[model samples]
Target: MSVESVVAAPVAKKVPVEREHHGDVFIDEYEWLREKQDPEVLAHLAAENAYTEAQTAHLQGLREKIFDEIKSRTQETDLSVPLRIGDYWYYSRSFEGKQYGASCRCPIDAEAVGIDAWTPPQLEVGAEIPGEEVLLDVNALAEGHEFISIGTVAPSRDGQLLAYSFDVLGDERYTLRFKDLRTGELLADEIVGTTGGATWSHDGTHVFYQTVNEAWRPDTVWRHRLGTERAEDVKVFHEPDERYWVGISTTRSEKYLIIGLHSKITSEQWLLDSATPEGEFQVILPRREGVEYSVEHAVIGGEDRFLILHNDVVDGVKAENFVLCEAPVADPSRMTQLIGHSDDVRLEDIDAFRDYLVLSYRREALPRVAVWPLTESGYGERRELDFDLELFSAGAGSSPEWEQPTLRIGLTSFLTPMRIYDYVPATGALLLRKEAPVLGGYDPDEYVQQRDWAIAGDGTRIPISLVWKKDAVAEGPKPLLLYGYGSYESPIDPYFSVARLSLLERGMVYAVAHVRGGGEMGRLWYEQGKLLSKKNTFTDFIDCARHLIDTGVTAADRMVADGGSAGGLLMGAVANMAPELFRGILTSVPFVDPLTSILDEDLPLTVIEWDEWGNPVADKEVYEYIKSYSPYENVAAKDYPAILAITGLNDTRVLYVEPAKWVAKLRDTKTGDSQLLLKTEMSAGHGGVSGRYEKWKEIAFEFAWLLDTVGLSGE
Candidate 1:
């Protein structure tokens, strides 16, 4: 038999399951695919994988070429700029052929000025630093495992003990482990199913971490002593509400341990003095519905004050744009507005220092940082750090020490490589520490980046970031891949990617659509595209693609689109709404069966997602509204753009069954002969596959397939 005949796609056996919601009846033929562990389901997924490999067999060389191009552009052996925290200057280094890096630290020079004074060692890429202590060799730990991810690498305050968390299966449920850094020996204590973030107490005798529930939500915080068994760990706090997930962290100054409970629309924080490790935590502020706030401990005017960034009513004014407020630690409810709320500026975060307060906010849809110097009496004038790049991203980096005089700032754009800067507040100078080493002599001037706006159906302007090589001239409409993820209020900001160079070098354009569901334009932008307004997210994406076609950037026949997770929902909706706009679609871990998934509140993360997506089980209107656009329910007898849905077996965020059922339905329902492929990573979870080399190869495969779909593989 021929190889093609041996790898033909499997036809899924359908046992139609009739589901009723809001008095509406629906017949789902592929519902049986949700039985993930069933032998038949596994066989079907395996068949799909074999079929994907067979269909793309011709593009194996192209995939390798793309992977090599990515490798050639990246600096395989590199060292990150050291960040000073406490008495050590810490950094991670990647070896030439290693899949992971080594986290190491070196003692500060004894001749430094102040008690908190430290200077980063200036070392060559391959040169070794003096007194370098390897804290964790991830490459060594990753050996013999198909998937390994190091979640948290936190060294204790005294730098004697290291609390690290790692996941071996890509399931995100990490195992918390400890090591005696001085002796280079592993501790016997091991805690499983942790969220991975370990917060150390001031004396370093205890570490606090959160444990994940059955639904994979971190809901309980536990404190484990250095020499105690995991079973003896004390439950410091437990959040009974399923919607609110919990996390624990210590203040930068190591003064207090914070237990944060977060839901979709509400948040509550509890504080425990690091000095009193066993003491009960006190609530910083009680939780209020529809109000969100974060607390930062700051010492001002000889008194410790809580600097809060919140969206609560202030002076009878609705805090639409978040306001920075100061509240006495004793009386947290009594807030004094420090920086009054403005319609244009949205306060995002506040990082407190011993002598200054760094405010990160958004103005004009771009991130801006302002430094407020602390005086004996009060705060002085706020000075904003200016950047020359018009379309770039800049924010605070690893400023670990609370008393440091310099702020580590990270800057990059679509065309620029990642650059690290040390901003000296006193001199107001942005000293360039290091720019990511791009192998083969890369120049930022060889690329062009621009910003354009697409008018949405409702007259809302959606931002689009475009980047391409300067020499890749477009005489006519070219192959363009537009990407978007417009959920969770997360901003899809412009970033530099060495692998993206392969596409741009091959005369392909890459654009990111900042649709309304994201926080790109502030909180209002996200509000208008979620819940009942969710359809706007799909429409906004469609509008952006139409605008690109109208502007002659790419024709409908040459364009491809992509989104992952919630954004995958957008991809599915667009495929149903405007399939003719693109030649291909890439949906990664897609949340396609929203109506069915949301209706089953017992499913993982379903209850928590009620705020982002309305509670379809309780509200009939929500059920009907969601059913109208749910990708799996909406698939009909029409031509769909060639689809490539990628998923993993152990994904808790969005089950692999979503894409599995989605592909089965698409294959059975769609009229056109366009490709419908599903590639399931049997050993991996939501992240698809682990290991740096494997990740690069996966991207190469996807890019090769995309290039082939648009007839650009030969180019």
Candidate 2:
């Protein structure tokens, strides 16, 4: 009997090497892609894009192919809403033969309000709860804004009050509002036009939140009384630190509020416990420098404490975090490494509940989940449960129904939409709740997930992820979009996307170059591509493209390279290196002037970012390296391929001024007949466009430009 299962059984097998990449055919395919084209097709492609009539006719064809491809390749999985919560899967799409029309508790469902086919769900996949209406329309709840969508939702400790937020159309401004889940009465509403987070005090007397200013930097802490409608929002805390951000969490007893100050990549937590919004604030732990700390909600032996997920600079920033013993702010001298990095894996998806730490992470290509009991002083031995598989996921709190045992997780992959489970933290055992399988006609077996490592000039192995329709590679160069982000320690992980369907179904090749500066391969991977070593990001991206061409994945001219922000900077630098090698180049909110960006500390995130990108101001070493590959400075008076650079009118980070300056320079200095076009979102900020349809339209328009410029139409 399954009385209590301790730790997950080892059922996940290692992913096998691909048959195609390992066989003799691999060499032939690589040579075939490297083989020079006949030049006849290339000439025709060029001519068609140049002639006005050909350009018009070709765009229509491109549109048809993109839609057809999206439908054909990703026909099995529901791309609408895909997330897992405790013992229950939360999605906007239909489930268990029941359909949602235009309102649901899901975030995406709320965003799709008013639009056709938009429906709301009660967050239930199947079956009915007694007295609980089998349905809840999220659309009806959106009262003030036409483009309102749920940003974040939080429940009081007693679960009596619920707080949520939404933003209007074309405006980055948000409205923080709360509603009584039981009474369904409007509680309180405040206009917050920034990236502020709303959470409640333990007793539910005070509502705490942090806000951002026009500069896009988080600046204030606002508090409101729970029962009052006319509660004045008095600012309780403010840190004028440039490029600094704060995250808040409260102790289980609600006696203390934890505030973490993050400057650049380093951070430390401070505590504040004020009865009124204007009460005195306290510092729990003194400030510590050069340490990276993160706070998450955790349950310890049926008691809740603010868990600190952190790592210290032992020998440089190549560090791994662990469960440090203490509150949100801990004794820096006593911070201990609870978990260590693996030789072939990285740890993530950490949460606390039921006296145990529930975690899900990747080992090689497989995913696994387990729990470690939260001991009085530290952490207990890790216990693995019955689920460790290739396509399974587990997490804490993806649902509101989970209560007993309280250990929950998410599981799914290429074929499965999502499977959520609630389990006993001490014992890995599934709890009864909901199962959300896709209702549409879609299958996961029609395509493949390929992982190939491309070796750079210095013999660094950069991982490249490829998702393509089976046997879709053509006898000639296939239309490919190569994407990468080489800064900010952001790992470009393997995740599914519905938007990618348009490309995959069209016999197009999609690739993600997990280049330098990403945490994909862990801390070392990030270290190799930052500051003085930043060139690694651009060079690594170039290597990924070269690898694709060299491996018969796709030819040079048949591809378009893309990135945004720092990745946009990546796109510009690489394009400059080989303008004749690409057919189109796409960038959004690009930081092309890397040297200038570092030099100007006044820019958003620039001053604080010197620790990551280096202050080229005083150090001659930093200055030379930055100028060596700064995209804007390197833009020679050479003709480039068709380029599409996107920006926002009010962007603060990366600044509209950045892309503004870069575009004007490109228009003046570019020698290529390659159309240099810039599109600015008049009302939006750093995020270019809003709304689902708007995003699709923006992407479609930009892609249309690529197809027209790269001569990939009318085939």
Candidate 3:
């Protein structure tokens, strides 16, 4: 990542002139673009403008209908009660013998329910703190109406002092609270109206935290001396600029603190020595110019050297590898690559136990954990920890094996919820701490997970994951939904899809296209699939459809592609490349105007994201490359498939206006009237339709769309 010598100190860059035509890779002139008026295009634009105006009412109606439907579908199931820890289970919050406080996601049976303890080798009913579940009739952890999960259970190193955070609305203004676990008494919460950002000092005698100050955007850090008599005793550590984000990484050593400052993407790492939280923060690494990689995070141990996780791409194509820099407290020597590059071995998690480097990664889309003795050169004699590592196109919410370098692991997959185990590297002994119990009547046999390789027209072998019921027809042109995302070196690994399972059981085939740009197959896969060469992603998706159809899995008419955000970008690009190859298209929050976005730097996250998209502004070659396929501009009035475009009003990353305008041109240009409907979340941000029930309803709506579009439905 090369930093341009000029920093945007004074309004940084010019406010990019809002382009008249999106997808215009290159234009003769901005003035000419704004001035040129083809009546035919303007006429099409007029009809679209009118339709968009009419949709103001239709969109309102749809919002009300969706909200009503969601509300009606929700509140149908009697929420589960929080259970106590016992032979079957106990609330972690209630388990006394457990080192940490017992907490569980069990349904609350009654209001103000209590937590109960449970041990596999069942503990005897002794004078230990009696485990019980005091169920709450209402959502105890409700986001707004009730208590929210403020910050993580901030307990002391000794599990004595506990600090936590909670908030109401999505505005993220949180309230910090501290409690003495032994006495169950409240302690001073130095920062009252705070968002989720707080950490404890190694000694547990002092607290370091940050809160959004005067500005609504940037934040400030503070340190609170524990056992203080006055609230005014807390000291302010540092105030970050509007463009920079400030955060603290607490280490076991009380002498050092890792201060992270970033303007979102380009980051600066600093180490500070604080007498109290109010101490000065000196610059450790004064903006490593042109070096842009997210600070993987650090383990503060002997000498307090930090192991940084950086996706150092040589030409900003595919992410290079994770590098470990031995920055002892104040020493930030250029850096060293602890682990070398691997298209397969993604540097997932680098954890430091008492003395080992627990390297958790995904190999060939399979979950793997490697243990190494921590050395200056990085891990040694890496031992692999094994479990089921399936690759679905979707992501896995469950974590992987290994609590840390201590040779302990906690593995969980989409299909397999959670499992805790202890491993001895020296003797190869594996001990199971806890195996996740099957809940919600989940059965793997109800469906299947399979991977197939499809070769594109250009000899590119693409991986496609097919998940459906075991008895699902092998030859039938089933109503199928294909998905893919190929950007930012993100790998869409194998993970269970509960919503997809619900659909697959109804005879619909769910497929994930492992195209280029994504770390699906590994480095080569990602490298071949990015930037100007990104056309491979579109062609590969088309190949996936053709291959599946040719193999008798499904015909063209039965294939429906779905992608959101970057995937949405994939969906739109694929639609343009092969419009008739699929039955329907769901492009949610898409970046349809990739060229325009890169050309215009005013867009939020655009300037910083140039590293990911390639600087078309500085580099003419990249500019021409992006302009060639910019989805919005290239959309000609052609016979196209049914397109459903969804966005959000408050999405700063991909503004609702992009979708609004894209759909406008799409509706006007499409040779056929493929139902082009736009749905916007009036309030939500990137993660749309949050909340368990709300999320489920949104899934149901999508399922309805695909079913309706492809003539397949469970109901």
RMSD of 2: 14.6
lDDT of 1 by residue, 597-636 (tens): 8878678888889999999888998988998899989999
Per-residue error (Å), model 3, residue 104:
6.9
lDDT string for model 3 (419-463, tens) is: 556566555677565544443566766666778889989886788
The sequence of per-residue lDDT tens digits that candidate 2 reaches over residues 1-715 is: 1213212211111222221211211111111111114363223222222332232333765665554444343323232333332212233432221211222232233233221112223333344422332123444443453344445566565655666666554344456777775687776465466453676776677777777755556667777776655347667778787657766666433555777678756776666663443466665445567656665555554444555555554445445532343452334344435565454555655655435666666554344667777777657888766553343334454423222345545655443455555555544556544444333444568777677889998999888877777765567667888888878767665556665655665577778888988777665577789988888898888888888888777887788898999898888888788776677888888988776566656555676778778877777677777777777667779878777777765556765545544554565567856656555565566776654445655666666666555455543
Considering lDDT, which of the candidate structures 1 and 3 is the better prediction for this target? Answer: 1
lDDT of 3: 0.58
Give model 3 RMSD, 1 decimal.
10.6
Predicted model with the maximum TM-score? 1
User: Sort by TM-score, best first: what order?
Assistant: 1, 2, 3
Off by over 4 Å in 1: 1-3, 114-117
TM-score, one value per model: 0.98, 0.75, 0.71
Q: CA lDDT of each candidate?
A: 0.89, 0.59, 0.58
Which ranges in model 2 have alpha carbons more than 4 Å from their true place?
Answer: 1-61, 64-150, 169-172, 180-189, 227-234, 251-256, 272-284, 295-308, 313-337, 340-349, 360-369, 374-406, 411-440, 595-602, 617-620, 705-712
Give the poorly placed runs of model 3, Cα more than 4 Å off. Answer: 1-195, 203-246, 252-256, 261-268, 273-319, 323-344, 373-381, 388-442, 522-527, 595-602, 616-624
Root-mean-square deviation per candidate: 1.4, 14.6, 10.6
